[model samples]
Target chain A: MESGTARIAVDLLGGDDAPAVVVDGALRAVRADPDLHLLLVGPAEAAGEVIRALDPAQRARVTVRPVRTVVGMADHPVAARADSTVRGAVHAVRDGAADALVSAGSTGATVTAVALGLGRWPDVRRPALIATLPAVAGPVVLLDVGGSLEPRPATLARHAALGTAYAAVAHAVAAPRVGLLSVGTEAGKGDRARRLADPILAATSLPCDGRYVGLVEGYDVSLGARADVVVTDGFTGNVLLKAIEGAYAMAGGPPTGGGAPRAAALLGVAGTVVVCHGAARPEDVAAGIGLAAHLWRRRATDQVRALLDGTEAGDREERTDRTTDTEVPTS
Target chain B: MESGTARIAVDLLGGDDAPAVVVDGALRAVRADPDLHLLLVGPAEAAGEVIRALDPAQRARVTVRPVRTVVGMADHPVAARADSTVRGAVHAVRDGAADALVSAGSTGATVTAVALGLGRWPDVRRPALIATLPAVAGPVVLLDVGGSLEPRPATLARHAALGTAYAAVAHAVAAPRVGLLSVGTEAGKGDRARRLADPILAATSLPCDGRYVGLVEGYDVSLGARADVVVTDGFTGNVLLKAIEGAYAMAGGPPTGGGAPRAAALLGVAGTVVVCHGAARPEDVAAGIGLAAHLWRRRATDQVRALLDGTEAGDREERTDRTTDTEVPTS
Candidate 1:
């Protein structure tokens, strides 16, 4: 909806029901946004179908990069050697063929491809998959939904900064309140990781006028009254997000505002990237593409990286803490 | 309702809105269950009102244990104290003056009081709080909902057995399918604790003909198609329950079956105990009391303990490669 041209690369063979659903979603995205251009990256046949389906004027906005699956290699028993389409999409962004990328593929493969191709931000050991839930008060940003299963306490503190900056840059939430998701709101109300991270978060400096709000419960993620940003380990975050989605389904439908998102934005990489749920429908893929464009137009990745740079340097100046062996990603 | 005299000790000075809500809930329970007897624990004046309202026939079923507030003590502040009415209610069960006990106080305080007064089952370091939610397929039992915030991998494995037995004895779930809660259903999909527990659960033998069905995602908790009982650390369980409750509220109301439960049954203690949410309403309090009476009448706690005993001994006899340091409570 932003008044700017945004170019995004579409991974045609990335999802469980790829090619067909991806094509349908790309068409929907192209028709919805007048200023949007797409660079479809996949097999020539799949890309041709999308290009031919568009009218003359609409066709002008679309381009294709031919990628052929290696025959005989497909039957090879190795997962790593397969000609993955997600890798092709990552190469498109890395090679400057597209401003951003969207994928509905295996999260591990997409993350691996992006981290390898686009390069991660310096000092971000584990790039997070952030999802924004449309809560009652405003958008509640949750992170590490499926990025790294296990992160150290220092990594969690670093994520707090990333989440804070993302809320300000992408969602425009002023003076965002950041909270660590735990069992209870009390000081010592969680597991050992949370107990260690609580004090670390309190000591760490946050960017974008964000302040740490000790601890919050899972209800805060859906209601958004307690904090604008909720940070947790990827494991808990992933399950919690899906659980909220299921809760909405059981309740008949989501709140009038919206429900848990089926897509998430990958942060800490050099380029803009959005990942949809593996079981996403056509509409979800379209939404992911739109999100990729929005992030690219806002220059969200660069802004968030800049914010993190300032905070990390400030943290270094404060003290020479034991930074070694702390699995805090230094891209 | 179970065709026997069931006396329940109700903690009057528990919960955010104590005495008033507790009184109202007790009145409802007495009216609904003709064979139910109530031992109201709180100030004499609060009990006097309830006694005055009941007819002579109903009055016979009600008794009171007066716990006057100290002169300088803050009003309602007594509700949060560990030695208040909830503690007295626990003692009533210990003295055989009541068949079971119910409280809607601070979870930590209630847990500590019951463990000290009624004594813990030998070998059990932390008790677990179990709640059953009515999902689409059937009742889904979730455990450790605030009992042990940080459980070791062995503790989680122990809970798997407890939950499996509980589903069979309490809910009469036939050969219940147990699952370890995680971010994804695949192996190596969760944080360190979950990753470690997955293999242990897979190797361990479950009681009551139960089977370990591997890892389950959050949606399965609400859908109940994948597993009958879900196991997680206390922190995730507590927050997830509250989040589901909040989601149901945002959805206008709960589904036709019911909403997330306000009351959870306490396991690993030597007595039958049920805990309601701190913000429990009168209806929630009544439900907590009802759950306690039902558990006591069915001898669910005793039966579950027996089943666990047989399983533990069997596990020892097998002496498999997997070894766990988990402590099992001995009655």
Candidate 2:
């Protein structure tokens, strides 16, 4: 529905059922959005299949990079796989051939490639993978899905700021209420990491009129009755998302708002990038492409970066003023 | 449907909605099972209310244990609250007056009181809270829902054996497959704790013909397509269970297999204890009482302890034989 010439690079050999699924997803995306363009980055045969499947009018909107290599799911992220299709897609985005990139491959490989190609935002030690779930109230944005598996308290506080900014920019949420995910909503109810992160998140300032609503339970993640943005370590976030998906499957299907998304946008990177599930279906891959195009059109990555920078600067200034206030004159 | 009389001590002053909800739950539980007997452990007025509601046949099945103190949800577990209703319920089990105890109170308080009163099993340093979810295949047993929030690698390994025994003894899951919960199913796909616990679980000797599956994702927790017994830290398990419950609510209702349970059994303690969610409704409280009665009738606690002890002894003997085989002849 967005109106803009947003060019997206799709990794043709990424998911478990690659090439075929990617081709189908690419075709679906091209037909859904009139202002969308795709730069297929994979084997020539796969790319040609996509072009041949499209109509003459839609053929003009598709292009190909023709890379063959791929990063396997078990491969190391920083290993010598520079010529992989995902990496090639990242290069296409960096070179301005595409405004954003989408891959249903290894999450680690995609995160590494995007961070290396586009660079990370200032003051961000680790990039965050943000997934938005449609809840009863509205969209609930969860961050650090698999970006940093074991983040410290400071990293969680930093992610709180990123998630807040993303909820406001990507979802058009006003005055987002952010909450820390824990076992219970009580103040002192969690493991050591949560106990440490709770006070830190409470003290940290959030952008876009965002405020910390203190500790929230797992129910808050799906119900969205408590907070708009939920922040946690990547390990917990990743498993929690999958469990919700499985629960929806057990319950026959998802709600009217839709189930947990299979595609998540990688924040803290310098460019708009969306990563789909490794076992994604054609529709999931198409959703990933749509998310990439939407993020590119809205310039969400750059806007979040700018907001984070202002917040960090304000935090530093406040600390400096506090330090000065605590100082006593020796004279 | 269990024929034997199950004497269950009910905590009268527990949960967010106290005496009123407890009174309602007690009446429901007494009427549901004819062989069930109750020892109300709280104010005498609450016990009188429950007795007055029942007919003459059921009136003889109920008794009263006068206790004035109640543990607040935010109160510290071990700090001078020994006379609380949960503690009194534990004492009722310890004194042979009750076969099992159920409380819709603070999980920490219940765990602490039961551990201290009944004493833990020989090799279990931390008690485990186990919850069974009805899945497509059968019941999926998940342990450490709130007990031992931040367990060590050795604790997780010990819990794997405990979970295997529980699945077999409590749920009658023959040859249950145990799995360590992680971000992904790959060998090295998890946080540092999971990476350490994976190999430990693989090497652990299980009881009741249980086998260890390498690793399982969060989906396995609900779907039960991979493993029958899923082991995780209390923190992750607690949140995951609540999230699934919320997802079921979002989906309008649970499947025919049922939803996430609001009541969990506390294992590793010598006596049977069931802890209900702090926000439990009347039916949930009734379910907790029902679970206590079921566990007591089946003697699940004693059976699980015996199985765990055999496994631990076998593990020790295996290590001794290996040590003996590696010894060099100095002569």
lDDT on C-alpha atoms for all candidate structures: 0.85, 0.91
Tens-place lDDT per residue, model 1, A1-331, is 7869988998887777888899999999998999999999888899888888888899989998877542121122233235667767778888888999998877777777788778888799999999999888889999889887778999899999999999999999999999999876768777889999999999889999999999998779878889999999888888888888888999889888778888899998889999988778888889999999999999999999999999999799655654653546566
Chain A vs. true chain A, TM-score per model, equals 0.92, 0.97
DockQ of each: 0.46, 0.84
Q: Among all windows of ten consecutive residues in candidate 2 chain A, which has the lowest summed lDDT? A: A322-331
The CAPRI quality class of candidate 2 comes to high
Estimate, for each residue in A156-247, the C-alpha lDDT of model 2 and write its tens digit.
99999999999999999999999999988889999999999999898888999999999998899999999999999999999999999999
DockQ for candidate 2: 0.84
Segments in model 1 whose C-alpha atoms lie over 4 Å from true places: A68-83, A320-331, B1-3, B53-56, B68-82, B123-125, B320-331
Give the DockQ (C-alpha) for candidate 1. Answer: 0.46
Candidate 2 lDDT, B260-294, residue by residue in tens: 99999998889999999999989999999999999
Measured against the true structure, the TM-scores of the candidates, in listed sequence, are 0.91, 0.97
What fraction of the correct interface contacts does each predicted structure contain? 0.71, 0.75
